[model samples]
Target: MKYLEWRINGFLEAVNFCRFFDLGYNGNRFTWERCRNTQNWVLERLNRALATRDWQNNFPNAKVFPVESASSDHAGIFLTLGVNVICYAAKPFWFENFWMKEIDIKQAVQTTWEHGKGQPIAEMIKSCVAYLLEWGKNKKQQFKAKLKQAKAQMTRYRNSSNPYHLQSFNSAKEAHLQALEQQNIYWKQRAKQHG
Candidate 1:
């Protein structure tokens, strides 16, 4: 009991210091689990993720979920940063400003350029454009799928009656909100490019 009290005090102090709240999560509830058959098992939430009020405002849909640990004693955490994935009409080719900041961008561009060398100028441009388009399409699809999954999970939490699920509902909602925000940013940037 003394140890438990000490832990509780420490937790309260940490929470106060950070000015953050727990991000609701779905999936495994406990981060730490140890068991040997049905005779004995211990479970505890040893690990957690917290977000500030500012972070909550910025990403209302952010969530942190525990994934299967497999061989490990502790579960892995999955954080959703909130991005809305939608099926949009095909967009025109345009370079993304963020791509310039990627360390591999130079290498990827150089590789594409090398592959297109010795071809006619128009054909070379076409090759590079095709490569870039394919790359972008794949990346977008991956992001879209992840966002969709997070949204679906949030919906599930909303429909449930379990107290734990209800508690997590807010966190899930926040993650969804974050995804919407991401969509807003994506369109805003695209609009800026056209403007």
Candidate 2:
């Protein structure tokens, strides 16, 4: 109970620090439950939607309610902005910054652009985009295959007692880490573009 209180206090402090107010919910009061139909069953209002004053003013009629789910222990919160939602069409082309790190990208682009000579600027752009998209797709597939193989090797060598196996495991582990770091950078660049 003391630990729970401490956590609650910390949450409250954070909320206050952010100047966020809870958007009161409707429907089932408890958002989570466990040990259903047993003596140890517990229910808790663990989930909530919060917003700042500016947001509240912008969408004064926003509403939040809990939706019970049969497949999960926690209820999903549904929020309505109480206004018409505008759906924007996705952009046709997005150049990933992470692609710049690839050694072949510059050469690939140069070759593609060279082939686009004597065409309109727009046509050249379209051709370059098509080539880049295909190139990016191939790179992504290769990375995934490399990562999978590294993971398999790491697992195979994980429990071996031989020093050679240990060295192989370490090499596989390093390859796996490098692949993951590259993937992380790719996603981070993508998130920045979208966000």
Say which candidate scores most in lDDT.
Answer: 2
Model 2: residues with Cα > 4 Å off, grouped in runs: 1-91
Score every model by TM-score: 0.39, 0.52
Error of 2 at 31 (Å): 28
RMSD of 2: 13.0
Clashes of each: 8, 0
37-79 per-residue lDDT for model 1 (tens digits): 2446677887778889898899888878875422466767889
**Candidate that would win on TM-score:** 2
lDDT of 2: 0.81
lDDT of 1: 0.70
Tell me the tens digit of each residue's lDDT in model 2 across 140-184: 887778777887896688556688998999898777766666676
